[model samples]
Target chain A: MEFQEAWPYVVGVYMSIWAVLLIYVIVLQNKLAAVKRELGSLSKAVERKG
Target chain B: MKKSSLILASAGALLLMAGVYLAFFVAPDTVVRIDDRELVQFSQKIFYFHVPVAETSFVFLVLGGLFGAMFLGTRKRSYEQMSYAAVEVGFIFVLLVMITGVLWTRAAWNVWWEWEPRLTTFLVLTLMYSGYFVLRSSVQEESAKARFGAIFSIIAAVNVPLTFVAGRLDSLKPVHPKVFTLQGASMEGPMLAAFLVSMFGMLLFATSLYIMRLDLLRAREDIEYLKEELEVG
Candidate 1:
């Protein structure tokens, strides 16, 4: 906390940045997994069609 | 594990480390105290690493925007990948500059942060890049996301130079831009070498990270494509 005198805004700023980046990465992961699941289901349907 | 990419990335890392060694250890420290109330350090040691990488970030930012524009124009996946890659690399380096710059500013100017034009512009540019990434992820449809991204990239690119120029000249009436050149000093020999090496290393680091991330993105795409193929059969 001593450093706060030197840098009042930095701790908050850093956390905000990482939080945003973390959210972005999580979203990407979620999307990728969902897409994979959809593709897997579609494949099973096509196997029946063939 | 492409041979050339790996080599470039490693070489960049090595040179950057060497530059760091020279900076903190080799270059002389300069303290510029303003009005006795605050001191600004115009040191030789920090400059070698600071200036080059800062300059390099601009280059990468422009490259990223250009690729983003091209991807929009051509609808090419590679261009989109390039745009993403360049921004990621640029963002990483810019983050370093901001961190280092803050320390220098505190030691020299007796302030941790200021609404200084350059710093403000850098912050804006960073936010813009983050927006680009956020836009990319917000959409699930590839073509639609790329289209919007391409447009955003073009707009962001158009603003990059304006933001930088405005930051520099934010004061001078018709000539409002601040003309604060490195009014500090010239760096020669070992100091310059260190700066150049660090710049090269940062660039290489960005490239390597881009390639690795890109490989993952492409692999994911490939898997998606295979799934579609199986479903249609």
Candidate 2:
């Protein structure tokens, strides 16, 4: 069988896998950034109180 | 990323690329015997990645359940974090498995979805774990959330075996192929090699992701603890 016939399905499967994983990685990164910001603010508040 | 994790990730990426190349170009195309006719199947190539991803998901879920059990026994926050991270990672792999499986079914069986035993049970397993997240969010108290999550995780883990065995029970005409056996696999030569490499690559990728997620969770917890301590001081 020619690859052209099944190319769409193949591409769809591969692309979906990569896209989902990429989305996860991006979400994790965003979360780490948000946590860092929160930690910075908390540390500054502690310093001012001390 | 840590140096070791970076190396592992790079190796996994290279192996996965090689596996894909071998699956499409090096491995010989397969033919399926159906109704006394041999049909050349191009979509069987998806098996290389699909099986590995499915297996990875199963491994992570089992680990998640194990950690959940440990959390219940020890009441350690770390165990709960590990359980949550493992389940989160497993969810991603499960999503991939369903997407690829659907595509394969459409290509091979000429149907997008069916109420087959394996398919139905797997869907149930997915829903059960998804409910775990919902359960966690619903509980406001830390101890209550962890306890409920642990109990649900164990129950969901028990369902894994049922999901796996559902298709093999009667075996009169299962759409899912029983390829792996106790002694050996059914595939041969290049096809088997490609599958093995892909499986290794996927396991490595899953492990690295799990470690990264666990670290992130721990860091978040540490920050929360520090904030609490500072407020107390």
Candidate 3:
């Protein structure tokens, strides 16, 4: 196949990959909520232990 | 811009140009079997960029393991965040490798996937690394999560090279079936130049991404710290 004909495959792959990345980033942001809550509670414990 | 970003961006551009030039011009075009009957020409050209960068993904996987081990040894949370960022990048690159591999397989083998040894190893590696993130998220304690994440990262990383070696071993079954031996890898002048450019460019790109993600994670940690400080004050 010629380069022009196969170029679509590359583009499609790129697009799909980016979509997955976007979903991951969103999930990461959601995950930060858990991190923040842990930090809130854990720092208090660290302070008390010290 | 940060120093690392500046260096990486410039290097990535130069490398990208060189790799592209070499792949399109210097390397010889390949004719691969598209199907039992049909053959695909020029489709094999993707190897120059696809294979080397695919190989480079291992760098991040190992880095993730090292940082995880460091965190466990020192009980430092910085190491956990660092490991997390690296694994995130590693996951992205692995996905890219799978996509490129699938494309190559379709064009070369007329199939999307097979349970071949190397490919299966990669699939397992991907799952193992994903488990690292999942394990981290499941626990609630900050230090425990950090410690657990670090340990998991090390274990997950150890799997990557073993997977690679196992895959290579499986490919040596010449007695059962004949396989294409890519014996001649001679690169013409232009093809070599293009390959160098692309590989270097990708390296830069991956580096830039690593730095950016690390910074983001650090900043998030800082904000959490500040909030805790305010509550105490």
Candidate 4:
């Protein structure tokens, strides 16, 4: 297959790979930050009680 | 994220980029020679990413099963968390595999999907593992949820190998390509290098994600425990 002929499929595959990975990493980062925030608040609550 | 997982993720990203470069520039385009003609398979470049993602998913799911077994044997919370994390990360890779695979199928076979042995078995494998999450969420008790999830993970892992071999089995008449056989891999030279680099990169990346998710699960558990203690006091 010539590059011209195969470009669509090749581009689609790479695009899907990177797009899915980028979305997943972004989601994971946001979830991690949220967890950290919750944990920090919980620690403060415990400290105040103590 | 932990320092170790961060380093792993960075290294994995670097290697994957190198793999892409090698796959495009260094690896020779696939060619087939007939008596009077040569055909170049440009779309075959997708192999560099597709196979690696599929293999990585298999590795994670297998690890998920192993962790599930450990949890069952020791009744440990950490093992259960690890198993869940592995499945979640593995599921992401599996989805990528399906997407890239569909593109490849269309390019090579002129069809988006075929109900062949490999494809059917793989679809079943995906659905079975997906049910693992649904099973966990449906259960109300922590211990019971973990136990059922562990058992499901083990059972699901069994399907992974079946999916892998479905194409090769004699009766199946599969259209899927078999890259590895008893003798050796079918690829060589720069092609093999690209594949190996991508494979290891994907494994490391998935491991980093698994560690990150596991840490989050542990933190959530700790938060729940502290909240319960605070309420009791």
lDDT measured at residue B98 in model 4 versus the true structure, 0 to 100 = 87
Write the residue-wise lDDT of candidate 4 on B132-202 in tens digits.
98999999999999999999999999988999889899787988989889999998888999999988998
Model 2: CA > 4 A from native:
A44-50, B33-38, B171-173
lDDT of 2 at B68: 94
- The per-candidate TM-score of the B chain, in the order shown, comes to 0.81, 0.94, 0.84, 0.97
In candidate 4, position A22 carries an lDDT of 74
Query: Evaluated with DockQ, which candidate comes out highest?
Result: 4
Candidate 2 C-alpha lDDT tens digits along B71-159: 98999999998998888899899889899989888876778988888888888988888898899999999889988988888788876
lDDT of each: 0.64, 0.84, 0.69, 0.90
Docking class of 1: incorrect
All models, DockQ values?
0.11, 0.52, 0.15, 0.74
Q: Ten residues in a row with the worst lDDT in model 1 chain B?
A: B172-181
Candidate 3 local Cα displacement, residue B138, angstroms? 1.6
Candidate 1 per-residue lDDT over residues B1-233, each given as its tens digit? 54666787678767766876776567554444557754323333445555665666777778878998888778889898777767776666677667767765664456777776667777787788789889889999988887787777777776568756765563622221222356843555666666667767766755665665565566567666766776555
Ordered by TM-score, highest first, the candidates read 4, 2, 3, 1
